[model samples]
Target: MKTFARTMLAIVGGYVGTSAIIAALAGIAVAAGGMERSEAATLTSMLGFVIYLAVIIWSFADPALLRVALGLGAVSGLSYAVVLLLARAPV
Candidate 1:
């Protein structure tokens, strides 16, 4: 069903957006507060995933923006994954 697909897309978008925002914020907070690197990373990753899921569930009413949402979501997800991986290694 198209409606179902749209809903799923929207949810995914929301999740990705929320994940990126949460992760970035957490990273900033940890850096500013002088928290342990490992602790900060863990907290950030967890918070990102939780917030992402919550946002996706909450944004199920807007079907018109499904395609855009999906694209943005995928981009955000990929960006986060790449950035996180990069951060874990020496440049």
Candidate 2:
């Protein structure tokens, strides 16, 4: 059961967290780095794969399952909040 929970979190939660991180990064690149939207999206999308892989590896490497859950949840939630704020900012 613990293994199953970890696997699910590593796969599903990692994906979700990575997606939010990518979106937030892309938005930051566009707004702060002064990059074009398409360029930022492309760059961040590529990095997303690596980030997802790392997230999965970390999920498994971490000894504490509760810590993994909380960490991933915090990352996903905070990243999504950043994405929302960026979306609302004036162009």
Candidate 3:
């Protein structure tokens, strides 16, 4: 039961972490005006699969469950927060 719960949490973490990271990166690129919006969108869309794979692998590779949960959760929160902030800010 405990292992199952941990696995579930890992899956969720990987999903959230990868999505948040990608969103944040794309948002920042667009908001910062470093690249064209269309280009940023394209790059992020393509990169998402790689990021997702990495997150999934990392989730299972880590031996410590606490680290995986907390680390991924923190990363997700930070990335999403930046995304939200950028959303409110004028581009």
CA lDDT of every candidate: 0.65, 0.94, 0.83
Q: In model 2, where do residues sit more than 4 Å from their true spots?
A: none
Better of 2 and 3 by lDDT: 2
Question: Which sequence of candidate numbers ranks them by TM-score, best first?
Answer: 2, 3, 1
Which residue pairs in model 3 clash with each other? none
Provide the RMSD of all predictions against the true structure, rounded to 1 decimal.
Answer: 4.4, 0.7, 1.5
TM-score list, all predictions: 0.52, 0.96, 0.87
lDDT of 3 by residue, 9-44 (tens): 767767778889989999988878688888998899
Candidate 2 lDDT (Cα, 0 to 1): 0.94
Rank the models by lDDT, top first. 2, 3, 1
For model 1, what is the alpha-carbon lDDT of residue 50? 74
> lDDT at 7 for candidate 2?
97
Clashes of 2: 0
